[model samples]
Target: MEMVRVVFLTVFMFFVLVTVHEWGHYYFAKRAGILVREFAIGFGPKLFSYKRGETQFTLRLLPFGGYARMAGEDPEMIEIGPGQTIAVRLGQDNKIKNIYLDSLDTRRNVIRGEAEFTDLENELKIRLNVDGEITTYDVNPQAMMIRGSQQTQIAPKDRQFGSKTVGQRAIAILAGPVMNFILAFVLFALHLQMAGIPVENPSYVKIGEVSEGMPAQEAGLKKGDIVVAVDGQTIGGDYKKMITLTSAAKGKEMNWTLKRGEETLSVTMIPRSMEGETGGKVGITPELPTRKAGVGETITKSSKAMVDTTDLIFVGFKQLINKFNMNDISGPVGTFQLTGQIAQQGIQYLTYWAAILSLYLGIFNLLPIPALDGSRLVFLGIEALRGKPVDPAREGMVHFVGFALLFLVMIAVTYNDILRLISG
Candidate 1:
């Protein structure tokens, strides 16, 4: 039952995060007048689907990733080559409104013949040999291409992704990461509202909670007791200095001066060495004072926190690059385990965890890795400078190779995660 709950929560969190990210791309692509073929969640067989306007929205079986597929994003275009049989249905204006590639035997009042040549993107016309006479027919702008039971709209040159200006294309690609950042900010603010904002002053360190039978509790220290000094050295409310002193004590007796409600008291305690570690702990958690925030304060504090978190993530990434440790990184399995642990703590912790994950997702996507948003922006920048886009075939090959390499890395990371879980 515990495992089940964890799995459910992990999947739910991933679903929410992925949906928001893809929605960003879908929204901006529509705004830029690009024809989005599909907005799909997950990568496996479709479980549900709905059509709205020119886009088909689908939910698939897998829950790990999703995408907003835009027309002309791929290098290969759907073609009706010479000698291939096809059927066409004409509208009132005598233009082909639907082109059927299959299932022509059952349909009535349709012209079936061999396709001599076709241009669906620019010319919007098809040349066919009907009863030994070759003739060309114009196709409607919104004509449907039917294959079996599936129907997809033909993308004209104007509605394709590549036809848009550089600015519009950049926005469509950049919006996904931007939306993730917005979600992180909103989550951070909501968490702060539910759980009071932390006090930023670092002058004094007070005991928030005391563990039973710990060194601090045995020394008669209680919650709300402010540490004034340690070993005759004034703390001056420096939390890090006080922590350093106690951790260095290493089971040695130390004199501590405490202030409790306008009363000064002296106490002596010995720090306990942590198991499998060098530092000594007194078993007391420091109090981070918090209070309810108003609307203005919430906005200010949340923005500050978001910025601080982003800086920390960049620092961490630098350190990771310098050292390049595999264990330092987490994959899907590790994230699932961590999510379960955080969800068990409380709603406030879970909300904060989600915010942190969202921010990380946003920042990670901005790295100049191939097949990512950052690399797309790089390509756009090159196109703007050169006044033309790169060769689509070469670009597509690079992305495919990058995607394959990333898949291998993901497999390695996931395997490591499983090993750690099993050994434990």
Candidate 2:
């Protein structure tokens, strides 16, 4: 039962992360006036689906990943040939009715330059270009449907993803990772508030070790003894404060209050006040204390946590590249195992893990690898600079290769995780 519970928790966390990431893309795409065809929470066969506006939101079988399908996001075919003119028609069949190219009438039924024909929300238009003279004819719905045909292809001017400006496309692509960062910040802030954020030091200092024959050891102080107060002054977990008070009170009888576990005891001893290379010698090392944070402090801590986590991710990436540490990488199996362990630690630790994982997802997705948001932004950047979009087919091929390599890397990482699990 415990194992089942762990599995459930792991799956639930994965679902939440993937759904939120996809929702980010959907939200931005909609805001950019692009038509979102589908917003799916997972891959594989659909378990359930519902249509909202023009988008079909679905929950699929696999919980590994999700996607937001925007219209015209996929590659569309375009044909260029030496001809007098070509008639491009938008209909249920996508078949050109006639070809007036080279002034010779020819009837060939072929789907030319297919576009996404999922829905017919726009008018049906047929393009006629004769000797560089271009004209568009808006065919009547009834006339186009005379032979059991309907408008299946969308024009470039329609509210499709490819029709959007480069800036808009970049925003839509970049929004997914941005949402993950925001989610991480919110989670971290909540965890800090509930768990009482850890401060530098709290209200007492612990004696780590005492040198024999020294004042602290001779006065009966020992390791693990927490100094609560010295000479009526509360140390309040400040080890430095206790040292300063001891230094000033050299040669005077000092009163010490120590907390040994649940019990407190008092001890008195006189300092030697000897001058040495190591300043005033208390002959005892202290351990730091943890201070609990309040509301404002928690917020500040959470913000710092976000910034620190981001910096750590970049540093880790640098190390991975420079040191080539494959062991440092974790795949789905390792992540699931870690998630289960965190779940057992309690809600606060689990929340903290969630925040870290969210930040990781956000940063990792921004890597300029193909099939990723960062890669899309890179392409858009090139398009912006070049004053036009790259060929769709070439771009699609590049993403396909990158995705294949990434998939293989994931397989290797999962294998390593399994081997490590079995060996350990």
Best model number under TM-score: 1
Best by lDDT: 1
Cα shift from native, residue 259, model 2 (Å): 12
Q: What is the per-residue lDDT of model 1 for residues 1-424, given as tens digits with 9 covering 90 to 100?
A: 8767766777788888888989999999999989999999987899999999899999998665789999998843457778999999999999999999988897778899999989998899999999999999999989999888878789999989999999999999999999999999999999999878677765777887788888999999999999899999988657788889999997799999999999999999999987786777787888766779999988998999899999999999999999998999888888888999888766688888899889998888878888888888888999999999998888878778877887788889889999999997
RMSD of 2: 11.8
**C-alpha RMSD of each candidate structure in angstroms:** 5.4, 11.8
